[model samples]
Target: MFQLVSTIVIRRLLVAIPTLLLLSLVVFVVLRLLPVDPLAMMLPPSATAADSAALRQQMGMDKPIPVQFLIWLWDAARGSLGNSINFRQPVVGLMVTALPATIELAVVGLVLALMISIPGGVIAYVLYKRKRETAADLVVTLLQSIPSFLWSLLLILVFGVLWPVVPFSGRVGQEVTLPGITGFAMIDLLVTGQFQAWLSALSHLFLPALALALSFAPLVIRVLRSGLIDAANEPYVEVARLRGLSETRILWRHMLKNAALPTITMIGVQFGFLFGGALLVEMIFGFPGLGNLMVQAVRGNDLPLIQGISLIFCVLMLAITVVVDVLYALLNPKLRNL
Candidate 1:
C-alpha cells in the first residue's frame, strides 16, 4: 500500500513539472501578445519621449521578444519571477506573502462548502426518495444559483455598512495590529496570541465564505444526488437490503460511501475555480490576497506579475486535478491496479 501511494504521488509530481512549464509558456506568450506596452503603461502622464524610451530600456522592453522571454524565464527559474513594475516588489516575494492568504481563504471556503453540501445532498436525496421534498432542498438550490459576487456585495452592505458587525475593507479590523505569520492574518494572529485580530479577521471572512459555499453548493448537490441515485440502484445495494440491512444504514453507510467519488471530484474542481473566483470576493471585502493582487497587476498592465500569477493559477488547477485523480483511485477499488 505504501509503495502504491508513493508511486502515485511521485508520478503526479513528475507530471506537474511539465504542466507548470507549459503554463508559464502560455502565460508569457499571451501577455506579450497584449497590445499595451508594460513600460509605457507604467510611465507617468507627464513623461516625455526620452522618459518613455528610458523606461522601456530599463524594463528590457527594448530587447528582442525572444531575448526578453529568456530574461524573464531565467528570473522565474531563479524564483524571482521578476519585480512588479507597478507594486515595486519582487513578484515572487509578493506572491509568497499573498498566496497563503488566498489558500487559507480557499480552504475556509471549501470547508464551508463540504460542511453544507454533503449533508444537504444526502438529506435532499433521502427526502426526495420519500416523495417529500424539504424546504432545505429549495433553499439550497436557490442559494447555489445566485452569483458569488452578488452575495459578496450583499455581505458588504449588511455586515460592513448596516450592521457594523465586521469591517469589510481590510485584512483586519483597523484597531487590531497584524503580525505577519504565514501571511494568512487569521491563522497568524491566532497562533501569535493576537486573538482580537484573529476574531476580527474571522468576523470579516464569514459572510464571504458563506456566500462562496452557497454559490457552489448546488453543483455539488447535483453531483452527489446523481451518484447516490446510481449507487442506490446497484446490485450490491439490493444484496445488502436482502441481507436484512436497515434501509437507513444502507443509505448512509453503503450507498453514500460508494457515491462519494464523484462528489469529491466536483469538489476538487470547484476548489480550483475558487482560487481565481475568490479574488472578486477578496476585492469586495478588502482582503489582500492573490486575486486582489492579480486585479491590481492587470489594471497596471504589469505583464510580469500578470504572467507569473496566471501561471500560478494554471499550476493550481493542475495540482487540484491531480489530487482529485488520486482520491478517485483510492476510493474506487477498480482504479487500484490500473
Candidate 2:
C-alpha cells in the first residue's frame, strides 16, 4: 500500500514539473505582450523619459523579453518571486501573508459545501426512490442558478444587515490582535489560546464561506444523487438486498461507499472552481485574501505580483489535481496496479 501511494505521488510530481514550466512560460509571455506598461503606474506623471529609462534599467525591464523572462525564471527558481512594483515588497512575502487566508477561506467553504451537499444528496436519493425527486431537483436548481457574488450580497443583507447576526467584512474584529503563527487566523488564534479572537474569526468567516458553499454545493448534490442512483442499480446492491440487509444499511454501508468514489472525484474537480469563486466572494466581504491582492496588482499593473499570483494559482490547481488522483487511487485499489 505504501509503495503504491509513493509511486502515484512520484508519477504525479514528475508530470507536474513540465506542466508548471509550460504554464509559467505562457503566463510570462502573455503578460509581457500586454500594451500597458508596468512603469506607467510605478512612475509619477511629471517623470521624464530619462527617469523612465533609468527606472526600467533598475528594475531590469530594459532587457529583451527573452532575457527578462530568463532572469525572472532564475529568480523564481531560487524562491524569490520578484518584488511587487506597486507594494514594494517581495511577491513571496505578499503571497505568504495572503495565501493562507485564501486557503483557510477555501477550505472552510469546501467543508460547508460538503456538509450541505452530502446529506442533501442522500436525501435526494431517498426521495428519488419514493418518486418524490422533483422537490430536491427544484431546490438544487435554485441554489445552482444563483452566482456566488449575489449570494454574498444576499448573505450580507440578511445576516450582516437585517439580523446583524454575523460580521460581514474582514477576517477578525479590530480589537482582536492575533499572533501570525500559521497565517491562518483561526488556527493561530486557537494555538495561542485566543479563544475570543477565534470566535470573532469564525463569525466573520461564516457568511463568505456560506456564500461559497451555496454556489458549490448544488453541483455536488447533483453528482452524488446521480452516483447514488447508479450505485443502487448495481448487481452487488441487489445481492445485498437478497442477503436480508436493511434498506438503510444497504444505502449507507454499501451504496454510499460505492457512490462516494464519484462524489469525491466531483468534489476535487469542483475545488478549482471553488477557489476561483472564493476570489469574488473574498472581494465582497473585504476578506484580505489572494483575490484582493490580485485585484490590487491588476489595478496598479504590478507585473511581478500578477505573474507570481498567476503561477501560484496554476501550481495550486495542479496540486489539487494530484491530490484527487491519489484519493481516487486509494478508493479504487485497481488503479494502484496501473
Candidate 3:
C-alpha cells in the first residue's frame, strides 16, 4: 500500500511540474500579447512622457518579453511572488492577508454544499428509486443547472434587497471590525480569542457561502443520489441483505462507502469550480479575496501579479486534482491494486 501510494504521489508530482510550467508559460505569453502596458494603466493621464518611460523601466518594461518572464519565473521559484503594481504590497504578503478570507469563504461554501448535496442525493435517489416522476427531482435538477452567479445575484435581490436577512456581499460586517491578520481575518480573530470579531466575520461570510452552496449542491445531489440508487439495487447489496445485515447497515456502511467515490470525484471538480465561481461572486458582493485581487490586476494588466496569482491558482488546481485522483484510486480497490 505504501509503495503504491508513493508511486502515485510521484506520478502526480511529475505531472504537476510540467503542467505548472506549461500553464505559466501560456499565461505569461497571453498577458504580454495584450495591448495595454502596466505603466499606462498604473499612472494617470496627466503624467509626463519621461515619468511613464521611467516607470516602465522600473517595472522591467524595457526588457524583452521572454527575458521578463524568465526573470519573474526565477523570482517566483525563489519564493518571491513579486509585489503588486496596484496594491504596492508583496504578492505573498497580500495573499497572506487575503487568503484567509477566501479560504473561509470556500471552506464554508464547500461544507454547506456537501451537506446539501449528500443528503439531497440520498433523498432524491430514494424518492425517485426507479420511479422517475417526482417534482422534487425536477426542482433539484433545475436548481443545479442554473449558474452560480445568477443565484448569487438572485440571493442579493431576495436576501439583500427584499428580506434583509443576509447581507449582500463582503467578508466582514462594517460595524463589527477586525485587526488585519494578513491572511485570515476569521482565524486571526479566533486565534486572538475575539468572539465578537468572529461573529462579524461569520455574518459577512454567511450569504456568500450560501450562494456557493446553492451552486455546488445540486451536482452533489444528482451524482450521489444516482450512485446510491445503483448501489442499493446491486447484487452484492441483495446478498448482504440476505446475510441478515440490517437495511440501514447495508445502505450506509456498505453502500455509502462504495458510493462515496463518485461524490469525492465530484468534489474535486467542484473545488476548481469554487475558485472560478468565487471571481463572479466576489465581484458581485465586493468580497475582498484573491478573486477580487485578480480582477483588479487583470483590468490594470498587472502581468507580474496576474502571472503570480494565475500560477498559484494553477498549482492549487493541480494539487486538488491530483489529490482527487489518488483518492479515487485508494477508494476503489480495483484501481489501487494495479
**What are the models' TM-scores?**
0.91, 0.97, 0.91
lDDT of 2 by residue, 1-338 (tens): 67777887899899989988898889888998998889887789999999999999999988898899989989999999899989889999999999999999999999999999989999998899465677779889999999999999999999888999899999999999979998999999999999999999999999999999999999999999899999989999999999999999999998888888998888887898988998889899999999999999988988899999999998898888878878888888577566
Q: Which regions of candidate 2 deviate over 4 angstroms?
A: 129-131, 336-338
Best by TM-score: 2
Q: Regarding lDDT, does 2 or 3 come out ahead?
A: 2
Model 1 / residue 191 / CA error / Å: 2.1
Give candidate 1 misplaced runs (Cα > 4 Å).
Answer: 41-46, 129-131, 134-141, 161-164, 336-338
What's the lDDT for candidate 2?
0.91
Question: Candidate 1 — worst ten consecutive residues by lDDT sum?
Answer: 128-137
Provide the clashing-pair count of each candidate structure.
0, 0, 4
Instruction: State the lDDT at 32 in candidate 2.
Output: 88
Query: Model 2, residue 317: displacement in angstroms?
Result: 1.1
Please write out the lDDT profile of model 1 over residues 266-325, one tens digit for every residue: 788778767766988888877788999999998999988888888788777877877787
TM-score of 2: 0.97
Worst 10 residues of 2 by lDDT: 129-138
